[model samples]
Target: MFQPDIEIIAHTPNPEKVCTAAVKQTYKKMHAKELIKNTSEEEVEKLLTNIAKLGHFSTLEHACFTIAFKDVSVLFEQFLIEHRLASYSAKSRRYVDFSEAGFVIPDYFEDKPEMEEKYRKCMLYLFNSYKNLLELGIAKEDARFVLPYSFKSSIIATMNLRELIHFLYNSIYGHGKEFSEIRKVGGMLLNKMKKLCPTVLRYFDILEHKGNASILASTYESSKSEGVELLWHTPSPDKSIAIAALIKSTNLPTALLKDIKQEEMERIIQSVVRSRRPRELEQVNFTFRINNVTLAILTHITRHRIHSPLIPSLASIEKSSSYVIPKGIKENKEALKIYREAFDRCMEFYRYLKSKNVPKDILAYALQSGNFITIITTMNARELYHFFRLRTCLRAQKEVRNIANNMLYLVRNVAPLTFKNAGPSCYFYGYCTEGKMKCNRFKEVVEHYKAWHLSPTKIPGL
Candidate 1:
């Protein structure tokens, strides 16, 4: 229920102040003792403008600011934390429980009482069901299976001057998509900064450029306008293509196999073995030693479809490309032969592994080279907790489970607040998404996590 604004108790990296001081030093260095020189503050502001045009960003980082933040959403909080240079504190879920917490109602939800009523009913149902479940011996862990992501929380963001400037650029008036609740707060904070350090905060003094400057020769150009700005993008992939090419190897004959090098025999052996698994899912249990080239191919192919691979590397591609339909005028059949042999060898091994009394889980792990494929998914505390609850289950893919586990290590250190209580169904979510397979011990899991990990705390005003 409490929505707060920026309360700057302190700050550093005052760019305007530093630029003014730096520019004035130019005079003091020259005059030394001669001139009773205090450069007019107007001169300082003008000098700061030119300095910004020169793109000296580091000078700005010297200025710092500490802000108090209150009442932000979990998603928005994560967005702030992702900006590493900033620090945060938020309200605790455990010590100060949300049992009677007042949550934020989205604009549209509040605008329509009927819609709000339905929404409140749903959320209340979830909370009450969870509470009742807890009272009825179903753990809070199990009860929380119904909670919605709209649950609101708050945080306090403490950042340096450079960061504060950056936040201002992204979230102020006259900015695009200023609807982000945090950005509005940022605008208010910037106003306060301008007041405390009038000469220093001159860079964000935009009226000079955006308004009066339009009475111009080249239209707001010659004088060079300025202020803070932030830019971000979904960066393009940069992994080397050569890696993909390298993975194209060993789907053929000339390549010497690590454990077996013979050509014709390995081919015959792998083919007969691989042919047995008719369905892609059945391939899940197949034992095949995928070479690096094969693994890379499988990586690209499976990511494209989430399907089981055929030959799983360059070899499969070559074999199929060669016989099924050939479009290229110059065909290198030898590469095709090597691929055939490698896959054959794998099929033979899979056949042997299947016949023996080996376990499905063990056989699944035995894959190397072509054996394992990894998916790159990134999430912070809240998201990671959700993923672990759903994906670390007995029903989740064995390989995905491994990935989820590995990611949890990074998640814990980076955003301790959100992830401290994150992990498998028993910990993050109650029971199972697959009802029949559920352990139904979510309450015990939540209590266990609560005992060990600190609940998130919302820091005031950023």
Candidate 2:
């Protein structure tokens, strides 16, 4: 009995006029303010039609929309966030007690009463288990591991007209059309767009399918390895960063970069890094293949928006038996037993659903937040430095901190000078930025990292 509640909270006023004015400013000598005031409604509509025909959509970015979604599954939330050109504020599972949070029952169950009853029982059991973990003094963050992917969550997403159109195209006609929930939401948003900016929709054809699912289908492959593996990195990363920096800082010609000595390159890298303007670091990149990452931690890593992470489809079945158990739950015998039993029950129900031949998309709702997945991600040196600074901190979640520390260790081996002083904010800045929430283990952290820097191969425990 789950229904998504979607509302357009706000949108750019006079959206067509805004887009039309933006288009006109490019060709006309008149300022945007004057052009908007002078442009007639009919003229705006005609101009937008012409612009759409010409395949110029950049002006569409001038119009923005803020939409709020409630009573939607976390699966849909994940799909929504995959549209990178948007802003999102989602309800936090860590802080929220989802014991009473409802879950989605896919349309596939409507025809089969017996299957629906079994599915309901499984969902209730998972929720009860989650609540029991809380009653046993487990933190909400740790207890959320037992929650299923179908659990209802809320999100407020904002996107410009161009991105919104792209999002709707995907949801309605692209790869997202395979999912019923996405199609429903896309239809609702399209209706709103029709009313708000009919002129824009008239020229924009939704039937022109933009998805490349067929072309990309053959490239899919299962992950064959585990843990963090540095799949690839830019060759001579330190030199790449140093060269980019020298090009910006010195008056020396680009031709002389080949003549520069290693000592001079190292000096330039040090100067650029210490200057605190690390844009040059973006010249180097690293790609990592991390396996067995929990859904909870996946959310944590994806929030760092500057990187590109390729995750499996939400409908895809997790083949690994691996799942995360927080230290708090593992240390308590009763909590550990409850946590393990919850996963076992969920998996048992999953197998039952699979035996019934339910589509993987519908069956995927049975997956626990603790379920593991493999992801491939690429990050530039600058973003990696930022990622390491925040995630390597003692304050960071243990699983993420471990991954961050490992990645830092790996990169330091190849690009030592670029990440020479990389680590937690305290270790990098010589002071904790968390104020009252600080870990107060400054000396321990500094000494550990200092040892780590000197012996790049050795990752000493803090």
Candidate 3:
């Protein structure tokens, strides 16, 4: 019987083991000989289970894994998206031509013939309705906007040792199979981790024990409190502070600016860029002009600061993005228009901004890296305001949370670096930061999150 939700495709060596190896290697400074060298797998596993004090973590990035997901519930899909550092490419709802559709039939429904028939009818009707919406010229996004999250989705996610540790810990220690029939799935993956990466996998086992202890303790407390159930929840809503949209447009195109230079097109554009006789700046007199440069100017400022490290190092630097897209060698009208508009505007803006008596601080923010044209964004590791204000909120977007998750993994890999014991407040404290604290899985959350940062295979502490 097919389950319509939640399945694991693949994971790397046990996360903790990778981490243990990484941490150990960073300090050891030797090529990673298998931590289980000269030892049997059973012996290695036992050692990992007992001797977890070797807190080194330097070579974790060397080991990574990619997991393929399919037939996931909205809850599970959302849960995975919270891990940002993992590379993902999901089937786009916008472009997928689902003229014909498919749906998974659960075991329970399959067992009940009548229910199965009803479910099948509903799926057909929903699919037809979606097709009809498209036929009516509704944008794919708007048409899909109403679709249920229960619909199937497939995503390929790439994870390094650090992230896998985080994902494994959370899934094994924190999550419950919402449908009650998928617990064995976790065991299957856990078994795999236990073999290939004993050191990291051992951490999962320890967390499992810790989780059980918590359950028992909670049960005892509940028993004393006359049969109260210990329920978990998300944190309270933040007060609506209307922070202005602080979007710093960088030297990036709104869309991925493709290099569409054909032999002739390249000759023309390059000629335009390096003209022997440059055109004089003649300001066209138009009072009604919006001076669209306000936002563009600000974005360039921030973008330049981010890419500065790719050229030179910043002490406050944590990490930078690799968002560059080299232009394509094709010709299209829109592409040509964009090339002309972007290059022209950028040149004009440069001259205009320079002519003005702009302040040094704002001017410093403008322009971009001389090379590497991707839309680079930088995060200052020491910037407490960024994390404290953003990561703790339940209302934060999922993509940002995933980014935060990646940041947490990277921080832990570098030990006592900017992100030590990193994560949402749950990792550092016994409770959620929100005043109401709706998600009661604080202990569970911390245990799950710690696996990524404290894997046995990676270096112990870097």
Candidate 4:
């Protein structure tokens, strides 16, 4: 019976006027400050109306909205975070105790009393197992592996008008249309926008007819795998990076790069990457196929925006025995028994729901935090460097840190020179960034990476 509780916590004051002034500054000689002062209410409305009609929505980016969502399912949370242009802060299952957290009952169960009872029983068992694991001295982070996707979560998200419009459009007419929960949330968001910005909603009809074709459907065929695999990368990534660096640093013609030797390219790559701002590294890109990634750790990777990660839809979640057990839980016999039993019960419930032929979207609620998924992501060299710097640190979550280490190993093999010094901040900058939370194993960590830097061809143990 859970419903998403959404509220607009804050928004730009006089959003229409702000957008109008932003639009005017693009064409008029007056600065934005003067334009805002002189623009009348009627003028603002008329200008925004025209701007919407003209499909010039960049001006809309100036008006931002911050929203809070409560009692929403983790499924919806995943859907919302896919809009990478926005900023989001959600309740962390890792730190928060969810033993008593209520769950969402899909609308399909409203009339089926017996089915609803069964569903409730299953949810209670999962929550009870989670609590029992906590009592058995399991870390909250590990105990959360049994929590289903239906568990309610809270999130605060900020997005500008341009991205908001895109998000709404997708919710109504694109991939989000496949899920009832997403549609309900979308309707609520649209209602909020009507009250907050009536002028802009007047032109919403234009968006309705405009099809959102960004969602693609396809079937992937691949062997079952675990760990990160380098699928593809720019051809001759080292040369690509070196030439880009040369173009930025010198006025030399593009053809002159052909004369550069392998030794010279190495020197150029080392110098550019070691610089304070290595913008040239962006010229090279790498795509990785990461398998057996738990949903809990997936958030860690996706939170690093500025990359494209192709994740499976919630509806695609199926019954599987695949799940992750943290090292700590594995070491405790009592905790390990409870953990395995919890996953077994969840999967057994999933099969029962499958026999009922419930919609896959709702059935996805059976998925637990530790359920394994495969995803493909592409990142530019600059962003990869940033990703490694944060996720390869000793303080990072163990699962994600392992994936990051594997990725570093792969990328270093192909573009050794470009990523010569790529590693944790301490290794890259020669100092730790974690203040009081320092791992205090600086010498050991530095030496570990130093070996990889010196021997890029060797496969290091993850």
Candidate 3, 1-462: lDDT as tens digits: 555333345655454445455545545545666652433446445444554434332345556766666665332343455466676766655468554635444455455676456545544554555566566554443344223223455667787755666566656564433222233334554566556566655565443333431222111000112111112111110100000000122345524333322343333323322334312101111011111111111222222221111111111111112111112301334433433333333334334434654322222212221111112233333222235234433433332343344434433333222234445655555566666635666666666656644563432211
> Which run of 10 residues does model 1 get worst, by summed lDDT?
313-322
State the displacement of the C-alpha of residue 65, model 2, in Å, after optimal TM-score superposition. 1.5
How well is each residue in 43-84 modelled by candidate 1, as lDDT tens digits?
A: 656766666566554545655666665554443443354455
Give candidate 4 regions above 4 Å deviation: 208-223, 457-462
Cα distance off (Å), candidate 3, residue 65: 1.2
Candidate 1 TM-score, true structure as reference: 0.40
> Which one wins on lDDT?
4
**Segments in model 1 whose C-alpha atoms lie over 4 Å from true places:** 12-19, 22-40, 92-96, 109-111, 129-146, 172-183, 197-404, 407-462
- Find the number of clashing residue pairs for candidate 3: 54
Off by over 4 Å in 2: 204-209, 214-224, 275-277
Clashing pairs in 4: none
Task: Please give the lDDT score at residue 453 for candidate 1.
Answer: 47
**What local distance difference test score does each model get?**
0.40, 0.84, 0.39, 0.86
Rank by lDDT, descending?
Answer: 4, 2, 1, 3
